[model samples]
Target: MNTHMEAYYQKRSDIYNHVRNASTYEKIAYSFLMACFTGIAAQIVIPLSWTPVPITLQSFAVMTAGIVLGRKYGVLSMILYCLLGLVIPWYSGMTGGLSVLMGATGGYFLGFIICAYFVGSISDKFPKSRKFIGMTGTLLIANFAAIYIPGLATLYLTMSSQGVSLSLSQLLMMGLVPFIFGDILKVLASSTFSKLVMPKEE
Candidate 1:
């Protein structure tokens, strides 16, 4: 906060002083907007195989959210998204609640937080990487770790608790392999857009 603002009657610096607050507000507002957009993306779900887990746009939005918002804002946006699930019904098949966040696919939702944080951190660290390849790598690795590890673990636990049996290959085929191509695409798009919009460092 500024301690004091001198009035420059002729130059009109007083009128421009509010820009700082407006910029801050604009950032927070954009975070909420990203939250809502990601929530909407989650609504388009496609079921596959006998498993309960289905492909959704949630991951794509998560990649974009992290790349675009950076660490602090990205995490804030996703947490807002998690909370908004209470009343917005933004999860797959239009479902939402504390229950869903703790359900079989809850790992994906929870992983979004970790993914966004690390991905954004990587982007910040290498903001000007050549053609943004570093950003793409960051996003891809984050997604892989976030979704594949936690997601498969949760799915395994959920299935095991329900007395289901599957080989390791089966688990990889069913849970991890299917999403690689999609995640790569999301990473590319996220990196490109983030690079385009991000301001150059001084």
Candidate 2:
């Protein structure tokens, strides 16, 4: 029930923002525009062997958006970003639309936004903590939520659609196992950078 409400709000919060917060035309434009820009910036492709989805930096921007814009705007930015990728060729590989949304990597792509919200909201709200534990926890949780779930789910669905019999182990091998290290690195990097730019105290 909680998850359902979050999903419901996550889907439509952008509309709410537009209705209540459009006090100035410039604010409205900037918010929407920044959302699109960050979305495009996040569509990065990582070249690798035997991996279905190229590691993209979309999550980084998603995280940054949340930290900078706060929960509502950060999610809105991601929402706009996703919409653009769906309607225009602005995502990784310059791809977009329903086809892309229905594509194998789409789930992870969507996951980026969710992760950003979780990571950003937590870090922004609770900035004070021991450097090692809080930061690491922040990064770890964010990455797990934002990246791992969606990435693995996408791989599972895509492979299943292709009529491939993917065992739990095989699925982990292809989807989760390979990216753990890299995601850890991203978490560390994002945490460090976030701390520097937007210190919790402010």
Q: Model 1, 1-202: lDDT tens per residue?
A: 2333222222232332332234767768877998988888888788877666787778778877776677788888899898889787988888888878877787787888888888767755665641367677777788899767888888888778889877898787778787778778777877786565553341
List of clashing residue pairs for candidate 2 = 86-97
TM-score of each: 0.81, 0.75
- Residue 115 lDDT (model 1): 88
List, residue by residue over 11-114, the lDDT tens digit for candidate 2: 44454344336665644565577667665665667756766666666666766666556566667777777787777787776777887777777787678778
Q: Candidate 1's error at 199, in angstroms?
A: 3.1
Q: Ten consecutive residues with minimal summed lDDT in candidate 1?
A: 11-20
lDDT values for all models: 0.74, 0.67
Q: Model 2 off-target regions past 4 Å?
A: 1-34, 40-43, 129-133
- RMSD values, in order shown: 8.0, 10.2
RMSD of 2: 10.2
Off by over 4 Å in 1: 1-25
